[model samples]
Target chain A: MTTTEPGTAEEPGRAGPSRTQRLVMGGAVLLTVLLVGVIIGMLVRLPGQPPAPPAYDSVDVGFAQDMSIHHTQAVQMAAWERDHTTDPVLRLLATDIEDTQHGQVGRMLGWLELWGAPTMPLSGRYMTWMADAPGHDHREPGSSEPGVTQMPGMATAEELRRLRESTGPEMDVLWLQLMLRHHEGGAPMLAYAADHAQTPQVRNLAAQMLAAQTAESEYLRELLAQRGGTPLPL
Target chain B: MASGKTSKAARRNTPAPLKKNSFPWGTVTAVVVLVAMIAVIGTYVAVRSNEQQARAEALAPFTPTAQNPDPSRAIPGIVIKEYPGGSHVGPDEQVAYTESPPFGGTHDQVWAACNGVVYDTPVRSENLVHSLEHGAVWIAYHPDRVSGEALETLKSKVTVPYTVMSPYPDLDRPISLQSWGHQLKLDDANDPRIDQFIAALRLNPNTHPEPNASCQETTLFDQHNPPPYQPAPTPGTPGARAEDESVDPSRPMQTG
Candidate 1:
């Protein structure tokens, strides 16, 4: 039961729309504003926020865990050379290897901790994650068997024992041979992660590792050849 | 416009439907949701900002790599010395050196391990200088003075090979990082130049006299059991430990 005149109010002096109409229009405008605000908030946030975290078994986590283990062996082998060799060039190389790989290990552990993932892989089935990655060949490497070779580039228990016992040129040559093979073995895994890992950090780290190892591998070959030796069989 | 004479009369007779006032639940709901989103996102952004800042402060601002090997930083009073193979003194005893903890000079032919060793006790100067000859950067930190973040930085940097850190109870400065013929003294462990000094010298064969010298296991002297650091006893002084405090039992007579 309200006034229906287009330009007149029930009260004669008031020439504009009545209070009820104003309230209804204001509420409608406010509702529209709220709707628009919410739509914008969601749309704006879509790209502003961080991307979803990697899965527990994602390439990022797997690469970090496996590479950390690989780096450990490299550090250990380099330490052996540092503690046993007399050749100036070999010592220089050993120091470089030990320092570089050790730093890389620390960086990997930090990333794993940030992701809340376990530093070590579940059980001993390491490097299996790389199997399904693009261009991978070892879908079921079968490293779990008692003596089927648990890890590529890793020294055998017998070999490690002998390395500890050996010294002089015999030890120097053995260390170079073992480390060269180890770096070559790790190349495939590094390349896989560089191409497949989702996180930029993971991909970049893998690329860096690949570049460093490739260069080091070349130098190690030259050093070995200079000393009248060659890289050990894979 | 419709003249509403009929509607005016109707309003007069029935009375306008009682004017109603309702809560603005829709606007309130939108406001609450928007505020919650801001609070959560704001907190996340704040936390992330803090974490990144902390990480930046912990490490040196720039990392020197092989491509950028020299950071072009200089040591304040780096000592340089040139000594030949036969110049280092006898292996059986401590020798006199002009530098406090000799960076390089004639010392024992045998060198203490520089394979990233952190000596719990102060090592003899003569042996340590040999490590310098082999291109090892020696980092000396005082146990009582350096601790916390600065100490952590020192420890992390020394973890790399061709570096060694030891406790110097009587160091004039809190920390002294030395390579063959080069030394830098500083009071703060977080000093950016610490890593700069290391990057320029550690295994950069150009600076080392015996860049190829062995740092492996030794037969000359046990690293664990080495003579302590002390001002070498004068040649004329009574060789007895009772007469000379600097003349420890392990070190023989110091020739001037």
Candidate 2:
């Protein structure tokens, strides 16, 4: 009886685990696996990691695309005036505009390339991103075509032709008139981008453009007054 | 010892009955947590895939492929040709080009200033062809055929850095868009294909000979007073093909 009793007691003690113990162990293992997975996911998304690229329709991208095109025209006109102007003051100003605007264009294009975005506006329209801003209309008056809205303050083919063909005082006065209006037109775009762009670099660039253009506008106004020329209506 | 054994057995049996009567709250909690985790992960995966699909769908039509070498080919009425690049003709000479307002072949040494310029006068075909080599889209309109609001509508399509618009005298079509070896002739400025043509071929590395070539005028070719357009010289004209070389149509020009 004694040997049988001892054997029975040992059998129950040696049995692996109770049903409840097995269930709890299995649950612990699964919980550990999930916890590890979540930790890894968090690490991957850490702020120290490189941020995701800007979205295609993001303010940073749209501003860069539109501003690059705007700067291109400014560079073109400045380059021409730089080469053709006899007045030292106008020549200096033209050179400055050409060099600065061209460099800005290169910077914007580089960003677009890195972001895998099209350098040209995908919609083939200008300033569409600014439509949501208060008191802004991105469309030109009577522009019926979907993708052919002319950017504000752009010199017409006739005006550019006249600037190219004119000489002496007439050329200088016309150039100042056109460029002053161009700067005035571009100021609002810069201000909007400066205030609302998502990327820090883009915002800084826009802010810099506003400051430089503001100073340049003052100079242009003085030069126009000296030349007895009035600014063109925007 | 027997009494002790009996007491231990009685204690184990007592707890077993109590455990069975009580609800298995721990097991229920574990199952619920596991189900919630799976649900969260599944939702995250689904959202990520949907976003990727939308982006792919947006870009697929415009993306170039080996089979569909030029995406613009899908547009109705687009004319595709194969032309050799880097062949230069002198300022005074001209190529007996197969196509009028030629898209490619034996261009002038200097490329007309593109960079979104809209020339009021007709620009030289040879120079504009050189611009094509540099990946510029030349929008040519017959002065008599397109005017007034139509002309203004056309001019607005020209965008900076790689687009040019000019009058092409004696153009067979009202509007012709030339980009390297590609051409799309259109009757209406409002045609959607015009935008499609520009989006597909302007600076398209696959379509143009010189992908790195500049659109800016680096040489003495004046933008305001660019060379006037002249008729292609008649076949067998002396010095017409003097500097022309046999370029491989399949090969892209080497960037200098």
Worst 10 residues of 2 chain B by lDDT: B15-24
Residue lDDT tens for model 2, B49-126: 898667845864553444345788788888888877778766876777768878887877889999888999988888
* Chain B TM-score for candidate 2: 0.72
* lDDT over C-alpha atoms for residue B143 of model 2: 95
For DockQ, the strongest prediction is: 2
Docking class of 1: incorrect
DockQ of each: 0.07, 0.20
Candidate 2, pairs of clashing residues: none
Candidate 1 residues lying further than 4 Å off, grouped into runs, are A1-28, A46-48, A134-137, A141-149, B1-256
Best by lDDT: 2
State the fnat of candidate 2 relative to the true structure.
Answer: 0.12
Error of 1 at B69 (Å): 38
* Candidate 1 local lDDT, B1-256, one digit each (tens): 3445445546567444332112245546656766666676677678878985564334322222233333324445555544443244555455545555557656666788765566778887777877887767899987899988877778766543467888877678899888876778888887867766775676544567764455543545665666677665544444312211232458765543
